[model samples]
Target chain A: MDEFSFINSIKQHSYKQSSLIKGIGDDAAVIRQPTQDIVCAVDTLVEGVHFSRQTMEPWHIGYRALAANVSDLAAMGASPAFYLVSIVIPKTWSSGEINQIYVGMKQLATKFRMDLIGGDTVSGQELSVSITVIGYVERNKARYRSLAKEGDKVFVTGTLGDSQAGFHILTNPGYYTDEVYYKERHQQPLPRVDFASKTENISRIVFNDISDGIANEANEIAEASKVSLILYEKQLPIKDSYEQFPPKLQHKWKLFGGEDFELLGTVSNKDWNELQIIAKETNTPLKEIGYVDDSQSNIGQVFLHENKQTYRLQKKGYTHLK
Target chain B: MDEFSFINSIKQHSYKQSSLIKGIGDDAAVIRQPTQDIVCAVDTLVEGVHFSRQTMEPWHIGYRALAANVSDLAAMGASPAFYLVSIVIPKTWSSGEINQIYVGMKQLATKFRMDLIGGDTVSGQELSVSITVIGYVERNKARYRSLAKEGDKVFVTGTLGDSQAGFHILTNPGYYTDEVYYKERHQQPLPRVDFASKTENISRIVFNDISDGIANEANEIAEASKVSLILYEKQLPIKDSYEQFPPKLQHKWKLFGGEDFELLGTVSNKDWNELQIIAKETNTPLKEIGYVDDSQSNIGQVFLHENKQTYRLQKKGYTHLK
Candidate 1:
């Protein structure tokens, strides 16, 4: 379809929010933010690098792009408010395919109660979707990756490695069993927006989303907080589907195969029990797998415990360069 | 360059602001808004479509990307606060080349007092820079394209057609003289951020940025406001640099060639003189080219007047598809 037609079709899917004074159809979207602080993040997913059209549906690609940005906001304990999407599509694609992408965006946007405010759509050689999400949090209450303190217990929400397993099944469709479950996880990740309200009583919490694998994220927390993370491999909450794989393969994926979109965070030991109680009350699975140490020698380091032996992880997680 | 090193190289250049609670190196960027209302807009620039690496420097590409977003904010009459950039580059690009892009972004960011807040860096087949800019405006003061009133005088900032002319020279160097002037205009069209303050006294001002040429933008304003825009050909602000072209060629570029990045708007005839005075005081060149009309037959139409004859424009200006 032509640009005007494409824009008109998606305009029907844009939902209005009270804070949004003017959305879409304007030079810029105007919003009256209810709060003083807002969290912002952006992520771009390109064809061939983030997804393959042959392996995934257009809707799933759109869903994953927004999901990545939502996960970033979740890490900050921010409530999703509005998002802008900039999409570039190849000329060969039909208008229907483009509509499906927005359909996917509308589905998730409805769930999060966020508005599709403003963006640009253009033609390019490769299909790419870039999303900017704006979220809000209470003053001085937003979580940070650098807030993990010595003696804090590291915890994660939900099971790890599911997205990676789903990705494997998607890319190698014939090689894996339980394809539906893994593909669904890979295609649609549930951002931990519920985590913010659930753990409101817990203080001194530092959090990050697991997009670059647990090991790498753990190292990031350690480096930013100037502490060491000692993760117990046996305690990792690997998904049941991932356990079907060989132990080594499961371990590798758990540590290095990123895109899980789960919340990885640390809380002071004093508040850990309160957080666990809240998680249980909220019906969210919370796993404690490590603790932060203050030793300078181990700062910026991640140690893995397996078979009653501790080993430092020397390899970094998945890099976008690949 | 690897993602980590690339992120570090640009981190030093990132400026800090009082409203920014956190900038980069975290789950997301946190900013404190001083105003109750904020404006946001996003745009993406793709290689081969927006610019060619062979014809433009990496820094210029970066500058243009941010400039486009800034222009959008300028149209809304907001003060730019911060911006996020999502850049995708081919793996073959060197660290130095990537650094140059950030250098260009930093240069513009500094001039506008906008901080490079947060974004994603990923690999893709082609280079694309997507920027989301956040700006603040006084409550109920932001301009809208849909606010134009009948009998309102249409005004354009600076001159038009220079960018299109520059683009021609850049693509076909041998065909044009005064290459320096045109090429510079094409490479960097100054965003009219200064217009917001200059027109503060005008009670009923509607604005839009002229990225899609006068004919297209006039039609947009007409359609949005349900009015007709009548243009006086002699009143069109054709740049002196563009005057060297044949009259026909100059008119063609003025009407159909876009990327001028000038402010286009309408102010009530009663307030027009005051606006012009303020524009002169601010040292901003503002030209009155036409007036909004209340003709039902000409609703959503643009009529160009030349030599006492009026003609309708049947063709739209440059579209991304072309």
Candidate 2:
């Protein structure tokens, strides 16, 4: 299909939202702001760097792209509203393949109730999907990474390391034949939008999505908030399926693996109990793996407690830039 | 520089706006909506497709990317506000080169008072810059392509075909030594945001940016509004610099060349005189080249009047999807 036909095919998938005045078929999309503040985030996924065509389906690529941007909004405690996607694809791809990609995007958009308002598609040497999501939040209710305070507990939603293990399985095909769950985790990450809404009423809570591993994001919060993070390895919430791997690999993946799309945040000690109850009510797996502390010498330092031995945790994660 | 350092280097360039609650260095950027409605547009530029490194400077590429998206908002008569950029570059590029690209973006952003709020940078085989601009417009004042009425006078701002000629000169160096104006026009087409603002008070006006040439965009306006557009070829806004080229080349570029980034729209005969006065005060060269007519038999058709002869104008332009 040509550009116009491809746009027409996917345009039907865009749903009408009360705030959206115009979507697609226009020079720019028009949307009414439901609240005072709007949250915006952008993320790009490249063909080989973010995903390989040999290991993943086109639909999964599309789903993952939108999921990553939605994860950013989830981190900000914003309600998903609209998304603009810029897709660069090779000319050799079939129209069916392109439609499948949009199918994946439409499925996720419907689940999140987001309007695919505006975007552009162009021919390129490789496939790259870049998405920018816009959402609305009350001025005072929006969460930020710089709100963590000393003595606040660092919490994460859902199990960790599954996405990394999934990546390994996808790359080394026959190596983990029984780890279908890991592969699925990597390909289809559920953005924790529902969980974020449950904690919207709680004040002074800081949140960020774990797109670049817990260690990397932990350092970001620590530096931004002028605090230090101390993580206990024993408290890391590793999934039961992850136990099948060797302990060393499990530890590596749990601490440094990215693309989990789970929410990593901090809540004041006073609200910890209340948050736990809410998490349980919402069916969100909340785990306390670390705590914030005043920096003594090394500001923004991260400490790892493993087997009762404390060591400095290096800031490292899945980085596409060398 | 590492990803963090690279982000930090550009972060300082983000100017503070009162409506911007948060800018960069977080999971997402937050902005307070100053108006009831927001306009959003996204466009992507790829190396060797939209530009080439040998023919264009890195800064020009970055400037062009944002300019294209800004043009969309101008067409909708929206005030330029915030933008999110996603850049995918080869790992071989230097930090200085990347900084130059941001420098180009910053120059334009500063001129328009637009905030470079949030984006992601990733590694890819080739360079691609995708930008999504968010602007504000009052609900009643926003223009649409579907609002053209029969007998409305069609108008355009500034000269057309300059960008295409600039592209030619840049690619074919030394061919037009004195035509530096065309080269600059192509590399940095100014978005007609100020002109759009000047005509905000005009009622029943339809607007679109001449990015894909007048013929192509005219066809869109005709089909969208269920009308026919008849253009007098002698009224086509070809710059004096464009005369140096052969007549055939000049005619082709003026009619079919894209990326001029000028506004094209229609206003009722009553508002045309007032619009001309406003355009002059704003230093915008507004020209009437055509008129919208009731679609009697050939609905959504465009006709060209040239050399005492008239014929149907084909709907075609510079499409990257070929």
Candidate 3:
């Protein structure tokens, strides 16, 4: 269809929210936020960079793009409220494929209660999607990486390395035939927005989602908070299928692989019981695998402990990893 | 540089604002808006569709991308507050070019008192930039395209078609050897945010930015407000150089050439004097171009009166325009 008709169709299908005074179809979407503080994060996924059209369905691409933005909000301890999508379509795509992309975004947006407020559509040589998510948190309640304190325990929600494993399986199907679980994990990784809310009551906490793996996330917190992070390798929660992979591959995927979309955070020692209670209440799988140390205060570092041996985990991949 | 270092560098150089509680380093940027109503607009400019690296400088590409989004907020009578940039970088570009892009965006942001809150960086095959801008409009003060009144006087802020002419001159450089005004107009079109606020106090006004030329913009108001818009060809604003073009070319450029980045609106006839006062106070170039007629109520249409003959302006394109 024409650009005007495409925009009009999007406007008609927009989900309404109480805060959204005006949705699509205007020069800009108007929203009267209920809370004073709002958090915004944007993510752009290109066709060849993040996903290939040949391997990924249009629906999955849409879901994954918005999911990445949602995961950022979840990492900041915010509730999803509104979002905008800008998509560039190539001439090769069919209109039906475009519809499926929106359907995918709609499903995730509906689940998170985020209204699709505005978007831009353009014709280009390659496909790309950029989504910006706006969310709300109470005044002074939004979590930050610099909030991680000494004696705080590092915890994570959900299993790690599964997404990378799934991606690897998809890329090398001949080697790992019949690995539906891995493929699904790569395509349909869930954002932990609900889990983030459950931990709101606990104080002295810091969160960073595992979009770029724990090595990077933990280091970010360590550097920002001026503390060292000591993670126990054996304590990491991995899927049952993780044992089938080589030892190095498992460590590489769990520690440095990207796109897990799970929350990795540190909380005060006293708040650990409180976090556990909320975890039980929310039915979220929570695991404590590390602790914050302030011994080396001038600079921060992340140390990985495995079988009584400890080594510095640089932001870059490990020597063994590459 | 690596992605982590790139993000860290961006975080260090972020513009600080009181409302921005957290900036680029975190998962999301937190903002506490001044006004109750927030207006959001997103625009994406693709490599080949909206611009080309060969024709447009890196600075202008970045400036133009953000300007388009800023204009949307201006049309809604909102003050620009914050923006997030998500850009896809191709292997063909060097780090210096990307730096120039951000420098270009920073120039506009500084001029308008906007903060660079957050952004995403990714590697891709094609270069594209998607910018989402957030602005605040006072409660019930935001202008809408669907608010045109029957006895309203249609107004515009700046001259039109300069951008199209500039683009044409650039593409056909040998034809317009000494023309620099048109080229500057194309590359550095200003967002009329200040001009939009002047009409804020005038009640019952409808606005649409002249990004896609006056024809498309005025038609949007006509369709939204369900009123007939009658324009006189004699009242059309054109540059002194416009007389040099062929009659058909002049009409096409002014009406449908696109990317003018000016404000087009209809205000109550009673408030025309007050708008004139605002025009004098703000030193804005405001002009009365047309009138809104309620004769065509159920569905709206736009008509142009030229040489004592009236012809309807279709949204698609004019027969005479082609």
Q: What TM-score does chain B alone reach in each candidate, compared with the true chain B? A: 0.85, 0.86, 0.86
**Tens digits of per-residue lDDT for model 1 on A168-239?**
676665766677878887898888888754565566688878887888788878877888888888899976
Candidate 2: DockQ? 0.21
Task: Give the Å shift of residue A71 in candidate 1.
Answer: 0.4
For B149-228, candidate 3 gives per-residue lDDT tens digits of 88899988878788988887888766563379888888888888887876777766777888777888888788778888
Q: Flag regions of model 3 displaced more than 4 Å.
A: A1-35, A174-178, A319-322, B1-35, B174-178, B320-322
- Interface RMSD values, listed in order for every candidate: 15.7, 15.7, 15.6
Instruction: Report the C-alpha lDDT of model 2 over B119-184, residue by residue, as the tens digit.
Output: 777889888999988777765676778789999999888998899888888777776745778888
Residue A2 local lDDT, model 3: 31
Give each model a TM-score.
Answer: 0.87, 0.87, 0.87
Candidate 3 chain B, run of 10 with poorest lDDT: B21-30
As for candidate 3, its clashing pairs are: A166-A182
Weakest 10 consecutive residues of candidate 2 chain A by summed lDDT? A21-30
User: Top model by DockQ, which number?
Assistant: 3
Off by over 4 Å in 2: A1-34, A174-178, A317-322, B1-35, B175-178, B317-322
For model 3, what is the error of residue B141's alpha carbon versus the real structure, in angstroms, after optimal superposition? 0.8
